[model samples]
Target: KAAGSALMKNEKLVEDIIKSVVNAVNIPVTLKMRTGWNEENKNAPTIAKIAEDNGIKMLAIHGRTRAQKYNGDAEYDTVKKIKGIVSIPVVANGDITSAEKAKKVLDYTGADAVMLGRATQGNPWLVGQINNYITTGKTSKAPSLDKKISLILKHILQIHDFYGHKMGTQLSRKHIFWYSMHLDQEKGSDFWPNINRVSNHSEQYLKFHDFLYSI
Candidate 1:
């Protein structure tokens, strides 16, 4: 019905869409897809071939079916299969939360790279850590508590400046929640509840500043 995995149900349609997009674009075309619509219909292999044949330059596959959504563990056997069947560069995505996990996914799936998503929500340094571990075999130290607080406050300020106070205050809540996940739980519990109620940028900023320093 929609324009995503639902389209995967019809192979001819998938091919037509891919060909159309590839022909319409001057830039290299890429595809990001799930394994399939459900457990019984994992057509990623078939779709991957269709995409490559239609001139898709690269692929990134999240190792879960559309039905599975974000609920269970992500499987890589399908991704491994896709990599083996396709000559184009493939990047593996899903549940790559740590540097070791990133390397393991790449090694296991033979993917060209691993994409980080939810794990990087508040921890931007995770990318550097993964790169360092992949290239140097060393884990980068986590930022100090003070450093985390500074970054969180700076991020909130930037959001406020960019989107103005109303929308920025609303948007900053999720980032704050994610960043707080790395901090003391008791303090986070208190801070989040209080911050969630604040509707103004200045008050939100002041409360966050006070909360972070209070830790």
Candidate 2:
């Protein structure tokens, strides 16, 4: 719904819809959005005000314009600006790949929170690490090689069970690759192609287990 607003080019309709959705549901309504449709059209502050006025409980702004997608550095100037405009809890999101970066984002934007997207794909522990570091100024210990392998093994089996054998393996492939990427950084991404070749679930599990532990 957020992405659709840029294409529709009508924040008013989006606002109306947001109002309707908020009025219709008992739960609080929240919003997530990029800076705007393009660099010149950074209307985040305007949108933030609209959302707040219409009873949005919280707002999450990705620090990039829609045109940039994942390219370029995320621009937090708008997030900082929006934080000043809206009274609701504001979340700043973009390029937060480490604990210090998350802290910097929160401090710079004066946002209520910092959000992570792609950074937590395989290293889900990062969420806790960043939080603990930010709150306590103590870095959470990264999992050792042995602990990482155990986590990876458990993750794949859970994925396999949730989606079942057929769809689960298909879904698990990309995640398996992500976990592999970090674990085998010394070996390089050549490891991914090897994982892609294993089609069977048991075979894939064994491959992930062996490959991750070997690292």
Candidate 3:
């Protein structure tokens, strides 16, 4: 988790892992890491150096210290410094929720690219949206109501396929909460208590559709 050390603390341990991965494969190697262990122990530059000293071709930096977690705005200044110190491509991550934010991050951090996390949870189309804007300088049309419903169904099916019925259904409930909140602004905290009472995936899906229909 974010509370733990960013990547593993032992430098040799990481080198060994990278060496093994490099030996096992014929292509480039990359690593993902947070700003550092905590506010005081922000060793991202050191870690980036260690990774570079090894064969890592790229490094992605999540711009929050372990102590910060997801509570505050990501610190792009640290990422900027990492880019200054490291020769490999540096990717920035954390709270990149929109194309505008993505562009700002790339410019601010001076990273080769930006990584999107929670922003893509229910909005995977964002990747294409960002690409369209970056390439064409225009945003795409919003998805139609019918497309939104279909995407909800598709997401449910994918979750069900990846995780079995019981677990998938359980996990889908949280996503359903997010969908409910986004699709129908009126359904606020009041809907969450009943979410646990929904019997199964079919019932939950039906409830969601009914809620959407009411909107």
Candidate 4:
């Protein structure tokens, strides 16, 4: 839906803006963009060259075009094409769920780097794990059940502190949902809709602890 009317839909205008910002700033300027407005207009290569010509220091492209909106597997051919067309560093993004997938994307696209977004919601340590594997070619052990439960609780509390109780609890619902998605695989399934309904900090903690102690 958003892809149909992206703010950066006009390539020429966006290129002009990038040129102005590049000329105006002393610091490096980077551009992040989708493949195009839709499948018919996968103009990532065109925009990558424009940014390079306009002095962008780097380019990061999500493998899925704007229209795809994370519905399917990310395609690396476009990123590879963009890298071929531009001399500046290009980073590939999308569906990099694990360290192995990260390595696979880098190897397939020959991208200068890889980026993560949705994969890091409650699993922030994934970045460290991915980095360790990428740099050392050795897999790190997954966090223990107790450690993961502790981390999820800590994460909810951090959000509560940062956003204040009301907004934080509301914002935390999705994070808790994602966290539970992983937890269900390990622990015997139980808390779900019941757990997500918890909005207040005290109640959330109570329910979380109950879920943990029960199993």
Candidate 5:
């Protein structure tokens, strides 16, 4: 079973697994987990202590129960409670889409850091923006249309090289779809379907190049 299942609610099983993993690993071990199995069974604080006791060097908590999955707002109260009880570094995660939100979550939970997930899918520059805000108290400017197009092209070519033509061309479609959503909405909707149909890397590349430049 996944760790997010009943294992989260079973403190003994949680501790035993952590102990075994820590004892077996020569390198430092870190754990990433949701708050708990469900709202009523939230046992993250108990698990956090168990992790720290069993030699976990760091913990990253996504502030939602496994039942909640990707729905609803992430609550930081549980994360703050976990941080207070555990000496290990705690990373706050989930719903952290912007620099301001990252700062807010860190300040609220007193976590050592924040982790960004789905939000960075099409907007990788968000990492730099967040870093700039955290370090300099200034937000980085959004990338220009040309810059976005350049990155999309570069990213697509790299994907092609890494995965080879057949699989690379298949994998690149999702990225193209994501990048398109960040651009012209109407055009992107129209363009993605056609791009999705292209089977070859060269054709996919040319279509993306023409569509982006045309916009």
Candidate 6:
């Protein structure tokens, strides 16, 4: 959602955010933003100072403008320049995947860190893998079948409990799709039948259990 023109144009929202959040908490303040609103209004540097001056401790910039949507290559040059202009730590985000890509982004953008988004879907251990490779030169072995099943079941239970049987069950379908899509050919097809039949929370759990027992 777009902010009102007055609020977006005032340019003091950054400082105000730092003031309010910094005053309200004892922890460090961090700001996340796009590459300004659009091309001609690339005011991240100006916003960065407002944050820094008002007590923000770190900044994260996604490498895209409002006009780009998710199209085209993410522009790291703006992120690189923001790192140069800001005194606080800067983190880069947008379409980052793999350890080598992470390394390349940090180097190219001169960011203090890289923020992983969609690439971490069903691959939560990615951060650990990249961190291990960067610090120890090795990625951990992939999770075994038993571990994968355990994680899927646990996640389903948590979602069901949090959102209740109805909404939680509805929410779990996508998660189930994500978890089961990587199974080997025979089991993959078997899993799809169970997933598609799910209509409610109890059915989802039952289907999941049935698929697991089949494995």
TM-score of each: 0.91, 0.92, 0.83, 0.85, 0.92, 0.80
For all predictions, the C-alpha RMSD in Å is 1.7, 1.9, 2.8, 2.8, 1.7, 3.4
User: Per-residue lDDT tens digits of candidate 2, residues 33-103?
Assistant: 88888987888889889989999999999988888878999989999999998899999998899998999
Please tell me which predicted candidate would have the highest TM-score against the true structure.
Answer: 2
Question: How well is each residue in 18-68 modelled by candidate 6, as lDDT tens digits?
Answer: 688899999987888777767788777777778788888898888877667
> Which is superior by lDDT, 3 or 6?
3
What is each predicted model's overall lDDT from 0 to 1? 0.90, 0.85, 0.79, 0.82, 0.89, 0.77
Q: Please list all clashing residue pairs in model 4, or write none if there are none.
A: none
Error of 5 at 202 (Å): 1.3
Clashing pairs in 1: none
TM-score of candidate 1 on Cα atoms, chains taken together:
0.91
Regions of model 3 farther than 4 Å from truth: 1-12, 24-29
In candidate 1 the C-alpha lDDT for residue 140 amounts to: 92
Which pairs clash (backbone N, Cα, C closer than 3 Å) in model 5? none
Model 1, range 123-186, lDDT digits (tens) per residue? 8889989999999999998788888788889899999999989999999989887777657667
Q: After superposition, how far is residue 203 of candidate 2 from its true place, in Å?
A: 1.6
Sort order, TM-score high to low: 2, 5, 1, 4, 3, 6
**Cα distance off (Å), candidate 4, residue 50:** 1.3
The residue pairs found clashing in candidate 2 are none
**Candidate 5 TM-score to native:** 0.92
Task: Encode model 3's per-residue lDDT on 124-171: one tens digit a residue.
Answer: 678887777777878886588678878887888788779877888888
TM-score of 2: 0.92
- What does the lDDT read for residue 165 in candidate 4? 88
**Candidate 4: misplaced stretches above 4 Å?**
1-9, 20-27, 185-190
Worst 10 residues of 3 by lDDT: 1-10
Model 1 misplacement above 4 A = none
Please list the residue runs of candidate 5 whose C-alpha ends up more than 4 Å from where it truly belongs after superposition: 3-6
